[model samples]
Structures are given as structure tokens and as C-alpha cells.
Target: MMKAGPSQEEIRRHNLGALLRFVHVRGPASRAILAENLGLNRSTIMALTSDLTAAGLVREELPRTPGRRAGRPSLVVRPESTRVYVLAFDVGVDRLTVARVGLGGVILDRREAARGRVAASGGASGAADPNEMVNALAAAARSLVRKAGDEATCVGAALAFPGIVRRSDDQVMFGPNLDVGGMAIGEVLSRRLGLGVPVAVCNDANLGAIAEHERGAGVGVNDLIYLHGDVGVGGGIITGGRLLGGEDGYGGEIGHMVVNPGGRRCACGSRGCLEAEVGERTLLDLAGRQESPDVPGREAVRAVVDAAARGDVVARDALHRVGTWLGRGVADLVNIFNPGMVIFGGTLRDVYLGAAAQIRSEVATGALAASRERVKLRTAALGDDTTLVGAAEFAFADVLADPVQVLARLRGAPASAPVP
Candidate 1:
């Protein structure tokens, strides 16, 4: 007997989702454009748009730029940014951000807090206490949600954590920066918020890469590498327009790659790791700045950059040394991945802009000539919001994957009940 094929209803739902996703990613587009892009007839596109509009996932508006000699302006379809939202969280070693983002990657509202990297006993380590971090994050999330008002429908929540997150469950496998290893972060945050929605935890750098690829420096580039810096360095790799997450989602831990043998101790209990050699702490220490709560991590990095700009020999020399190490790491990555672009984000953006010459020199010397000649090095265009935007994109994954079913579930659920 022949196998059964998908029902017509299934096909319609799939087409609806495809249209919604295209509009969401590519921005508001006309029905004619949508029909042409999706290879559907005008009638099919019209039906899909009607269904989506009735579902409240999208809105049809007159085009902002109408064509000349137009009779009636064609309506453009756009994601309903005000009504539907997603909670995006970024957990860094010294910073925490929570944002309410709308369907079309619009940031509706946001809240941010600076976290102290001291142990409960006031030790000088840069690792955040797990309990304290989680509590603070929960509080921030609550505040953001409350501020978003009850009328908004939250589709999902995604957290960008600076660590190796287990794919099986959103567990923190190893986080030298946040000190939250072996914790079920997603489950805890989900229960705390009581939103009844999926709370996803992903590597911070991976999210940064996603945000950059979609809207920032990597926009038009298929193969790219994103390197993020906070208390420790992390990397995100993208190949062929897809995130290259390894088995169990622990792939982009480039910070832990051994660069120098027996150089400095790393939080991962390894000696001479890339992060150990060139992370924020090392850069500050080399620049002769004392680590203290009085100076925030971002501020300290800024101080170094400022000093370098003022021609401070100590700061300039320190940045040069760090840049050389950073370049060595980049050279290895270039040889391995042969990416078309490499984006330096977070604190690394400052470092790269400050020491671009040294970094370029090392890459030119160490990387393969062919790969080096074709690659472009750029700073993150999204500035500090790259990871936060990435978190928003991550939250939208479920909604985009099965738009019809997910929206149906949302519409059917009680208004008082959080999205499940």
C-alpha cells in the first residue's frame, strides 16, 4: 500500500507558516512580492495573509513608499509588533539584561543590571554566585514582564548565558564566568517566572552570532565567526547561514582552546587557554589596573581603551600583547573555518578597534594566504545589543517553526494562563 501524504490542512498550515516567517525575517513586504518569493499564486498568498491577519499575527498596512502611477496603494504585511512579544535575557559575568521584544525583532521595553563578580565571601574572583545570579535574573525578568503590561501576549523567552549549555536540557554544563555549572537554569527560570512558556538557555556568543548575521555586521555574509568578550571570551561559528553548534551544543568554546603552553591559569582549570591569555581580566591586569567593584567590567575595559587612545605606553603595550594573542587565535580559526567574515563583539570590539593593526599583522602572518586575503574583519554593528537581539531570535524559533499550531495554542489558552 502507498504511504499516506500530509493532509491539505497540513499543507495550508505549512504555507501559512512559510509566509509568516518570510515577512518576519525580511520585514514588511507587499503581497505581490510575497507571492513571487514563496512561489505561490496571488490567490494563495491572499488567503494566507487573510488567515494570518485574522489570527492577529500580522497586520496589513499601506506601503510607506508607494510606487508612482499607482491606483490604490498595495497593502504590506508586517508582524504585529505591539500585540505579540518575547522575553529576551542576556546573562553575562558582570551584566544582566532583560528585554521585551516584539515579533518583528522590535525591542519594546528593556531593563539592565550590573552584577558584581565577587564571591559571597567577597573574594576577588570574577565568577558570579549561582544562587545570587539566578535570583537577580528572576527579579529582573519579573520587572520586565510586569512593565510590559498584561495585554501583551508573550510567545516565548530565551536566555543567552555565557557558558556551555547542554542541548538535551537547558542545563549549564560549565560556566567559568557565571559559576552556574550543573544547574537546570531553564527549569528554574521557568518556574520562577511562572509564565508556563518555554525558557531556552543558549550560549551568549551563539546568540551574538545570530543577531549579527541577521541585522548587523554579518548581514549578507553566509560564513562568519563571531567572537564575544566579557569576563571571559566566547566564540560563535556560523557556516552556510546556519549556526554550527556541535554535538550537545558545546561546540563554540573557543576560549578554552590552548594557545600558550603553561602561560596562565584559566577558570576551566586549564593552563594557557586562549581566554586565560587574552580575556578582560588579563588585559586589565596587564594594563596595571586593579580589579575592584568600584570599576565595572565594561568601565575597566573602557579605561584601558581610553588610556591607549591617550598614548599611555603601559595601556598601549598591554593591548598590543593581548592583540597578538587574539590574532593567533583568529589565525587558527581562519585556517579551520575559512569564514568570509569575523566579527569582534562586546569588549573585544573595543580591543579590535584599538589594536586592529597588530591583529591584522598577526593574521596576515599566521593565516593561510588564500584565506587571509579573502576574509574581512569587522566590529559588531549592533553594539551592545547583539546578544539581546539574538535572544529574541532564539525565542522566535518555536513560533516560526510551526506558526499555525503555536498561534492556535496561544489563542485557545486562557488569557490569564501564560503561554505554554
Candidate 2:
């Protein structure tokens, strides 16, 4: 069997990579800042930075702000021209977004497709094969690679599905929302593209959580949750400064928590689940079905909030309903995980903003005092780019931190090894 923990060399590389990532995300820093940010001494930072500079992974720039005590400011160190890029893909129920992101989380370019069941058709003019969607994604990625114009050394593609993902094998175990099951997306994408670079697959909400933790509102705090209220409900969790994907990578499926006993039925054959009550479809049904003005659920929630903003009773009632269900779900999470922060990401961010106070109020009242004390609820900072950036970071760290995983990708084998 492969080793259980990082090797000596792997530990060194991992620490160095973590140091660089800290600088990349937090911006230019002096030696003091670097040491403070990464908990490394000046000597350690100097040694690792020297190695990084020689490898063209980092550069020093003039400080943007002068110190209060110094005549001349110390040089600020940051990532350099040698950067990696990722083709980040977010596959939702009705849309697919592909973005070209740099190593430092900059979105260099992007493309989006407004696809629904048609995406299932896979551009075949008729059929909706999961492989067909993968093929379309491959084509989109190829176009992006060509457009990146020489800055692309390797393409790290991250696809976020709306269901369970076996990270160990990179297999999309189940995506009932997209009508897919047991598909090895990472393997097929690598074959389709012929690039032999690292490809990753993750639960959409988990990625959202990771994105937020790394670049969005969850920064600087561990024990956080990212609850996604969109077409379907999904969640991502972080604990102890690391993502909390269980042995099967299905640990963060919080939407399936049964909150109501006699509620609506869900795709998972359960009734009264949190997702059944607060999912996009639930809101659409509440707003009335087709021939009654087809308002997208998220849009409907927004309209309800907008009307409420103008003091409309009906809109106010709808928002209250949403807030109540959202609160119950959050209360349960707070009791269970006691996260340090809880972010409202996904389509809900826009709608939730109008009723955020009410939602937090409910959570604060309903959850335990200790749990509530530790949590600070907020909206995601990186918005939709969170997943894409997290995906790129995943690939960058995976490859550099674990030479074995890197060798696996180069040898066209599955990255079954533990992520460093």
C-alpha cells in the first residue's frame, strides 16, 4: 500500500507549497508577514523563498505601502510570472460555466453555456448521454487551452457535480439531479483531452465551501460551512483548516438531513428532507407551475424579496417561509458541527441578502449558545469563482505536494493516492 502520511521530502515540498499559497492568496508580504502568515521563522521563510525564487514560482515586488517606522519600505514578496492555470467548470442544473483561472485565483477568461436537459443530449442533436456532456466540456476546455496562448503548461480542470463524488477515484458516484451515476469524469476527461494533465471532480457544494474558505468569506477561520440553496440543496464543510471529506468523500451532504416528517418527497426517495422543502423546485411549485408565469425558483425568491422590500404582504410571507426553513436547517448544522462561520453561497446569496437578518435571527435563536457564539454567518466573497479557484488550487497542491500523484497523472493512471 502507499504511505499513509507525507514522506520527508513530501513534507518539505508541502510546507513550501503551503507557504507560497499563503502569499498568493493573502497578497504581497514582508519576511515578518510571511512568517506570521505561515508560522515559519525568518530563516525557514528565507530558505524556502530562495528555493521558490530560483524555481520561478515567486517574485519580490516593491512594497505598496511604507511602514510607519521606516525611511524606506521593505520589499514585498509575491508569486511570480511562472504561474499555473486551471479550466474550472461549474455544472449546474440549467447552466455550465468554464473559466480559465491563474495560479493566484485570477480569472483570465471564461465561457458559459445555457444548457439544461439539452446538455444531457451532449451536442449529439438528440441524445442526453453523460459522456456526451463530458465531450462538450472537453471541447470547451480545448478551446480555452488554445486561447490561454502559451501560459498554459498544464490544464487543471475541476468539474463540480450536484451529487456524491468519490475523491479517492475521482468518480462521480451519483448525480441524480443531472441523471448521472457512477461516471469517472476525471479519467474520461483526461482521455478526451489527451493533455495528460491533472483533472478533478468534486461535489458542487463542497467545492463552493472550499472556494469560500480559500478565497471567499470563510478565510482565516476554520470550522466553516457553505450551504448552497439552488436547484437542489448541497453543503460543504471545513474543519481544522482542512476540508472535511469523509472516507468516501460524501460526508458533506447536509441537504439530505430530514427536517420535516410529512413534507415533500425528494429525488433520494426520502420525504420531508431539507432539500425537498427549500430546493429551487419547491419554491417554483409554491409560486405556481407553468402557464402561471414560469419564474425560476431563485428568481421567484428574489422577486418575493423585492416585493417584500416594498412592503408587500405576499412577498413578505414567502420570504418568511424561506427564512424559517433555512433557519431550521442551519440550526441543525450549528448544533452538529458548530462551525466558526456559515456562508450563504450559490443562487441563494442574492435572495438571502434581502432576508439575511431574519435568517440569522432564526439561527441565533434556534441553535445552542455555544454553537451560535462560534459562528459568523456571511455571504461568499469569491461568488461563483470560488469553486474554480479551489479546483485549480487542488490541482496545484496535489501535483507539487505529492510527486506520486503527479507521476500517476503523467503515467495515465488514477490518482488514488491520498491528497497531500
What are the TM-scores, per candidate, against the unseen true structure? 0.94, 0.84
Could you tell me which 10 consecutive residues in candidate 2 have the lowest summed lDDT? 118-127
Which pairs of residues have clashing backbones in candidate 2?
Answer: 120-128, 121-127, 121-128
The best candidate by lDDT is 1
Error of 1 at 136 (Å): 2.9
List the lowest-lDDT window of 10 residues for candidate 1.
119-128
What TM-score quantifies how close candidate 2 is to the native fold? 0.84
Kindly list the per-residue Cα lDDT of model 2 for residues 10-50, writing each as its tens digit.
66777677777776677667888888878888898888877
RMSD of each: 2.5, 5.3
Model 2 regions more than 4 Å off = 1-11, 39-44, 64-73, 117-127, 289-301, 399-420
Per-residue lDDT tens digits for candidate 1, residues 220-274, read: 8999999999888999999999999888999878899888889899988989898
TM-score for candidate 1, residues paired by index: 0.94
